[model samples]
Target: MEYGNPDFVKYAEAYGAFGHRVESAEGLAPLLEHGIKTPGVHVIDCPVDYSENDRILNQAFLRAFGSRRQAMQKVLFKPATGHGPDA
Candidate 1:
């Protein structure tokens, strides 16, 4: 299911915190630096495109391991007892 994209900057500001909106990739570094150096709760609303997440992560996993299935097998933990929620 999809959710509404709320104005995170305004939300942060409403809670009496520092809010910064990154307009471009160049602005991200400066905003990050400012947020870290400054005091109080700081929120940086950096828009990210997650469309290529699966492809990128899968490629990285393939490079690290031999294949995506191998990576999943290594990372995913399976309970031997089978006494958990799913059981």
Candidate 2:
């Protein structure tokens, strides 16, 4: 381990789970809902390439659907509404 990262750093890194960062502004909708203020709960927005995402998603589909690429096509690609949860 480096000088900065000691033996305890590993444990800290494991415990410190990163927040579910979203790469899109439109995806901030559901986050504005209830229970958002709970401890350790966070939401962020950024940008990512859909094509690369598609490739990675395809692999995920393969795992989910036995290597079937069609599994990825049946996905809903849409942003979210920033309305409150009760809305």
Candidate 3:
């Protein structure tokens, strides 16, 4: 699951890091189990689809802030005007 970027497995291997390259969600459990059961450091290279991630994040954002007028009354979050109470 190496973020679909340049392979970094060599670095891990050089340091004796043990892990798995998970291309999908299904590979998570087994890799996690192996890491927990075995000793020493482990790593999981999980790549993600940027486009799909963007879409999902956008949808979640809309759902959370859909009712702007109502939400604004209770909380000081305003994405539209970008003005809110000091943190």
Candidate 4:
């Protein structure tokens, strides 16, 4: 579950393509513009901090579908081994 982040820029260059890494927020727009304007398979490695994913995504989901969460759980927990209509 914990696959470490690889150097995507180097990986792209290994394949003989253009690669760029966004070092700061301000650099993103310019790098994106350059990549789009002139490109032959460009890869931009923009590191993102997802530390608040659980708080942001889970809480929003719970708020939106709180009443239907239990109902949805039944379908989600159902076995998937069946192979036919009668199985």
Q: Residue by residue across 1-87, what tens digits does model 3's lDDT show?
A: 556466655567778887467888988898889889999888778877687886786576568878646556546653455457652
Model 2 RMSD in angstroms: 17.0
TM-score for each candidate, following the candidate numbering:
0.52, 0.24, 0.55, 0.60
lDDT of 1 by residue, 1-87 (tens): 978678999999999998789989999898888888888999888888888998998889999989878888877854366677877
Candidate 4 lDDT (Cα, whole model)?
Answer: 0.84
Writing each residue's lDDT as its tens digit, candidate 2 over 1-87 gives 546323342343467733444446766665545326556634342444567887887678888867464554445534456878855
Question: For each candidate, C-alpha RMSD in Å?
Answer: 5.5, 17.0, 6.6, 4.4
Better of 2 and 3 by TM-score: 3
| Cα lDDT for residue 64, candidate 3 | 81
For this target, which candidate reaches the highest TM-score against the unseen true structure? Answer: 4
lDDT for residue 5 in candidate 1, whole number 0-100: 74
C-alpha lDDT values of all predictions: 0.87, 0.53, 0.72, 0.84
Number of the top-ranking candidate, with lDDT as the measure: 1
Residue pairs clashing in model 1 are none
Could you give the candidate ranking by lDDT, starting with the highest?
1, 4, 3, 2
Which scores higher on lDDT, 1 or 3?
1
Query: Clashes in model 2: which pairs?
Result: 23-46
lDDT of 1 at 63: 96
